[model samples]
Target: MLHLENLSFSVHNNGDSKQIISDINLDIKRGKLYGITGPNGGGKTTLAKVIMGILTHTAGHIYLDGEDISDKNITERANLGIAYAFQQPPRFKGLTVEDLVKIAQPKLSNLSVRKRMRDVGLCPEDYLDRDMGSGLSGGEMKRIEILQVLARNAKLAIFDEPEAGVDLWTIQRLVDIIVGKYQNNPEAAAVLITHNRNILPICDEIVVIEEGRIKHHGHRDEIWPIIRDDIVCQVQDTCRGEEII
Candidate 1:
């Protein structure tokens, strides 16, 4: 369970201030798969980073399991069972898949490493011994990053565009892993930041962000139609374009 109250963030650009997020308040329930969707630069990723304490917020509070975590550092938040997977996953220069998995779960053996890779739709034989560096492709890095998240068994997982750069085949597998693996686990909850419609169906709730603010939050069925209508209306009116106002 996570709650963000009256959150706001801004940055200085060429001596001018630019607000990235404003008055964002949201509550994510346990064992639920929540989707954060919106047009580009809507602050969805920023909100994720704020919750993970990677980016310092200019205002408001963040609560994890009812306690305030706005002041916590990334390691502190991670120790509190909050995990974040970035849009562009970082490369580990010297680590191998086996090494990374071992780091996440020390008790896991080689067999478990293979199993975990299989679970994430990767070939254990191909990836288990591969270097987690430039040798691997972006998609491979992404999958490995996700595998690490799963291996950590964190209480709260924030995935920023988990489907990005992954092929359709892997995307389906990733979706299945998120829904079938984590969504059903009562011990953890997930927040998926993506614009992909393929993931919407499995989400328990869909939260739409626009211009750094939460514009809509509800069940998928309840919010999808509204989003669909809004898209149609915007396309019909060329002046509005695709901006989620």
Candidate 2:
């Protein structure tokens, strides 16, 4: 289990300190998926980075399975079975998909690599030898990055915007793979930060953050109705803008 006790973060913007995350408290248990969704600039990503130790919290404690990890660095946290997937995955000019996977888990075998590719809905022969560069589209790169995290077999995984820039079919496949693999592991947990409505359906619980505070959080069935209405409003606004253009 992962626990955040009154976690908070602040940063210097224009030489003035501004709080990005308020006194946020959350508990994440293994075998469950926790979805974080909200409008942009709501500190959702900041919270994930704090949990991953990418940014040191100004106050509060972070505990993993009863161990105090609040002061640990990003590498230390990763060594403790915590993994994070970036919103925009980085590209490696000379690295093949197989090579990257090997680096993630040196003990992974050729057969396992093929299986991982297939798990993410990619054909082994078609992607294993492909370079992790511009040749791969945003969606392909996201899937490959996810495959690397899966190979790590981390106890807790944080994925930021996993469905961004992907088509509906691809998003569906990715969400299924993520929820299936992560939620099925009795000793692992997943935290997904996304604005995609489709991904929310698979979550065990949803946390809605607004203006650096948690506006609402509860079981999927309980929270969906309120959030669904908000999402509908946003979509309608977007459509209106498109029509105007």
Candidate 3:
């Protein structure tokens, strides 16, 4: 559903260019969920942002369904069936949960909107009318973040650390929602930027991005040992409580 060709992004600081992502050639197929993980400052989030047009690529082309969207802006990409859920969700002081839901999917009935909230482990009575600002916890805001993304029903969804601050119940529901999105749709796919072990095993493919480039990319079973390595699980987050770090 999405193709990234020779993609690269760099930033200029003190007249020196520092590369964040370089020569990332990837094909994200429809009906598949891709898991992306790596160390900090590894360009994972930057690559995702570049795809969403939040950051302009220094070089290379981004194609969605065979059309070049490299030059498109954030709104344009979103309108073209792309959705992104941030690692750190944004704050909107005045907008209630219902308001944001309406903005994402105006056609959803009030009942449907509330149902989505419940799907994310949020109680409608307590959160439907609550402000999306300081009053809401990080986990709450993250749930709402995924809620809006899921509401868009985008062809390609990019989730940057969707499991960051949520409880187990919400994470489980999130896995269900994400996996269900492209399971039967031949035209939908997802890119998950995460380290949660609960999410990695189910992915059709796993990608490891390190030092501004893809270090390893392959089927899950082929790369599981490479990721686990020795003691530590190598992954930062705890995984199934068996050999958690």
In candidate 3, what are the lDDT values of residues 110-199, reduced to their tens digit?
Answer: 999989999999999999999986789999999999999999999999899999988887798898989988655688999899988879
Model 1 RMSD in angstroms: 3.3
How much lDDT does candidate 1 score? 0.87
lDDT of 1 by residue, 113-156 (tens): 88889877889878787887778888888888888887887899
lDDT of 2 at 17: 97
TM per prediction: 0.92, 0.90, 0.93
Which digits, one per residue and each the tens of the lDDT, describe model 2 over residues 141-179? 988888888889899999999888777777787788788
RMSD (CA, angstroms), candidate 2? 2.4
lDDT of each: 0.87, 0.90, 0.90
Q: After superposition on all CA atoms, what RMSD does each candidate show versus the true structure?
A: 3.3, 2.4, 4.2
Sort by lDDT, best first: what order?
A: 3, 2, 1
